[model samples]
Target: MKKLLLAAALMLAAATARAEDNVVKVNAPPESAVAGETAPAKASTIDCADTLGVSRVAEVDTAGGGEYGEQYPPKPLLEKGEVVLTFDDGPHPEFTRQILDALAAQCTKATFFHVGRMLKEFPDVARQVQAEGHTVGTHTHTHRNLGGASMGQAEQQIESAINIAEATLPNGVAPFFRFPYLSDPQRVRDYLAKRNIAVFGIDVDSFDWRWRKPEKVMHNVLSGLDKTGRGIILFHDIHGSTAKAIPALLAELKARGYKVVHLVPKSRIETVAVAEPTAAPAPRRRARRHRRSKR
Candidate 1:
């Protein structure tokens, strides 16, 4: 009877240990969870050189060029079969790393327009972006729409963003700016122009901010690109949906024979012009606006 009870107890202990091991395996974070994927997807690789070619270009100088606010797309619009990948409002701890992993796997480079506060909060993530050979730009300090802010408020937003980005990024900040909500006032445009900074306007808006699902975000981006052929594609890395959609997006870009153009500012933009009080542009169609879902 003693031998029988001892054997049963040992068996029960072994089973309990196995159950605990199984629990740990299931509860631990996944290695393949990058890009917000809950499970590992089939691995694939892309050679950007063979799939999407890269090019170097100077910033578009829009000073008094009448292409100031909503009209600014990269001058000499990207040629057919070419696309510029840019992300705004990022350095998100979860999604940014996933996006970076996807970009790295594809061996592609992109520009990240980070909010100042986000950058400060995730300095290591910002450094990771730089370490991955991607360009870093500012999207204002708090992401407040500069169009409505007072000149003092607007200057503080832009200047503080630049200062924070420069302090955090080893490569310093790139000379490119994107208006939050695509709300660019002529006053802000002129300020950037005077400092020789380039203002970015999107040709293809991902609208990922609206659709949080990866499949839907992928479809929206591809459909937008289909209409425009090639230009700057706006995405926000802060969105987990965007990160989840990127691998599929890159795959589709390869399938469609689209090329990725990586834009690097000719040099770092460090100067800030004295704020000049000027009128903001009258409300025009918001260039960065995306379709709102009724549901």
Candidate 2:
């Protein structure tokens, strides 16, 4: 009887060990499993040759709408050697598509500030930007220069842009705003603060709008980075020069040991209906110029 019990105990222990081994094999992660089903591809999977993938995503709390950029206070959004790519006035049918392809090739991400009218015209391109995991923000309707506009006009412009962007983007717009031409008036700034929309300024202006040549655009960007060390770099996706320069610029950045940081909003901005400025009352007609005309 003792011999039989001992053999029974040994068999049970062996079976338990085998079951544990099977569980590990079945449930182990892709990186560690010796035998198991293939794991699903990572959402952020990059091409095997892609080395300039986004180094990090900075999720920011934009409450109270503070300003950012080398031009604004509290330092830029990145550390030394880290760069944020931002484009403005975009969703151009041709140029924006080219830019998107370039970004995908490098597995990098960027922020695009889309003008409301442009988004309305080429909404598919704008959706592509969102689908590819880039951040979308408002650049105001018609790209109006807020500095010259009345406070009411400025608010309308800002709100209209936000509303349009929210309407167009699948995930809605980020709590980010860039003043057209970076023209931030105090009242507009205060209004943005009240709305909780964080402002984005530039550290390095690619000046692609001025430099039609891709090489020249790349050179200016590199020189700007050389000067500023690291910060948000601005480009315009509407410009063919930028579309052409993107691939080489990303490669050059990677070669120079610069890491790309993607900026994501911690919260979505609660948008409101766009307001229209009240029209001035029509002047009352003069009682009569009839007597003067008769004389």
Candidate 3:
């Protein structure tokens, strides 16, 4: 009887240990505290069934800058449960930082598309995003809807955005671009192709912009995922709702067996030497003269 009782206790302990593997626990350091680390901790080291961290990184070669997304062809070959996290229209002052905190809490890495004006306004915040080792890309100089703009204006918008982002980021910009408002004209699409910049489209739109509440954002994402299964998921770092939505969304993703895929460019995007138009030529000359007099 003693020998049988000891064997039963051993089995119970083993079962308990096995069950604990599925319990998701989050213990993340503050974003400011993780600067010294090379990259976010790889969740692959932990059992896939256990952690809500990055599952794998997909290195993409932006050769000829092919367009991709569920809406476009040659999607990133994700398995049924894998999803890529991408954010655009950042880096906002307050909300971007909050989103970063939530993402770090899960050890997840995401791709950020920074606007030129936003980059200039919050350069320090942009640098912090880079310091955290997330992939960086440009959206446009002003987040203008390119579909309505002249080809020259579109080119200028795209080029200026990349130039500003490359100059701001320590690592330079990736050869990745996403159309603002998902409005991609064939002419602009072909232009990006010529520049060797990959175009990204959305598989699932979180619509966090419309659904300002955390629960609404979460529902939209999970429901969309239910239909699409896997692809690139879009969020905006400028919204407080998105930051609030992320933690619970990540937890739900883990519970539902969804894995996060980090996307990296095989090479950096080559920027063209195009000068941005001066907003006020007279003011610029006056400022230069004032500085010269000071000198």
Candidate 4:
């Protein structure tokens, strides 16, 4: 009977092994991609390339007056009722420095969702960001909009960016990821889950893409910051207008007694041993293999 119990436990352990052994199957797109998405694929079947465990707790109206949506109790955006401000599509040599200077002057830290290509070109800036006591994250290599992209394309974009980030950062490091163009497809979120990366969709967006006026940008930014008690704030680092507006808006936030807290999502590692470092030596180099060979 003891042997039988041991065998059963062993089977359960083996079943749990694959969940943690996910080594980011980026070169290979998930099997669902082969199913030919004649229609929008659902999130349930999309194998999470890496899972990002974000416990963003906010009140959402669900027939009832309000309900809590956080998977776990979340960190309030600020220690003292501040906002979590995040910027993406950056590592731009000049603009990033400018934003950094502004935050530094205010004695605040912010999270910069960095792009891989930009980091490769402006590695110095990436280092400076880290030095500034701010969080650094992956914004993917090509910034491909994952909303309508194939699983393969999305995987490549995400994986290559991570590879670049790991190369850019120190050892024993994995950076958080945010999708490009605010890709919020449920499948995209799931894909990140499989890979142990978090999905960060904004609770408030300034919609800077629609227009470029600095005042207009501030207005929109202020609107979101005012409404949202907490969660991620999205802004573009790719635009000159956004750069121009950020300082002014940050100043406004200060006047209104808002503090900025740099935000990073919680991961599975916090709860269970979702992943264990493989001491297994990597296999020697060989030709790239893909189930669905790309052109």
Give per-residue CA lDDT, model 1, range 1-295, as digits (tens). 6674344333323322222222111112334221210111122232234422233322332223223222564345456877878899988999998887776555566888898889988999998787655678788887777767877778877888888888887778876788887777888887777766667777777778777898988888789888878777888998888999998898788788886665555446674543322333333333343422110
Q: Which ten residues in a row have the lowest lDDT in candidate 1?
A: 32-41
- Taking the candidates one at a time, how many backbone clashes does each contain? 0, 0, 0, 18
Model 1 vs truth, CA RMSD: 15.9
Lowest lDDT 10-residue stretch of candidate 4: 60-69
lDDT of 4 at 100: 66
Model 3: CA > 4 A from native:
1-50, 277-295
lDDT of each: 0.65, 0.72, 0.72, 0.52
Cα RMSD (Å) per model? Answer: 15.9, 18.6, 14.3, 19.3
TM-score of 3: 0.78
Segments of candidate 4 deviating more than 4 angstroms: 1-81, 171-174, 265-295
Error of 1 at 137 (Å): 0.6
TM-score of each model, in listed order: 0.73, 0.78, 0.78, 0.61
13-125 per-residue lDDT for model 2 (tens digits): 33222222322111113354232111112322213234576676666566688788765676436778989899999889999888877776666778999988888889999
Better of 1 and 2 by TM-score: 2
Instruction: Put down candidate 3 lDDT per residue, 73-99, tens digits, no spaces.
Output: 754357788898889999999998888
Superposed by TM-score, candidate 1 places the C-alpha of residue 273 at a distance from the truth, in angstroms, of 11
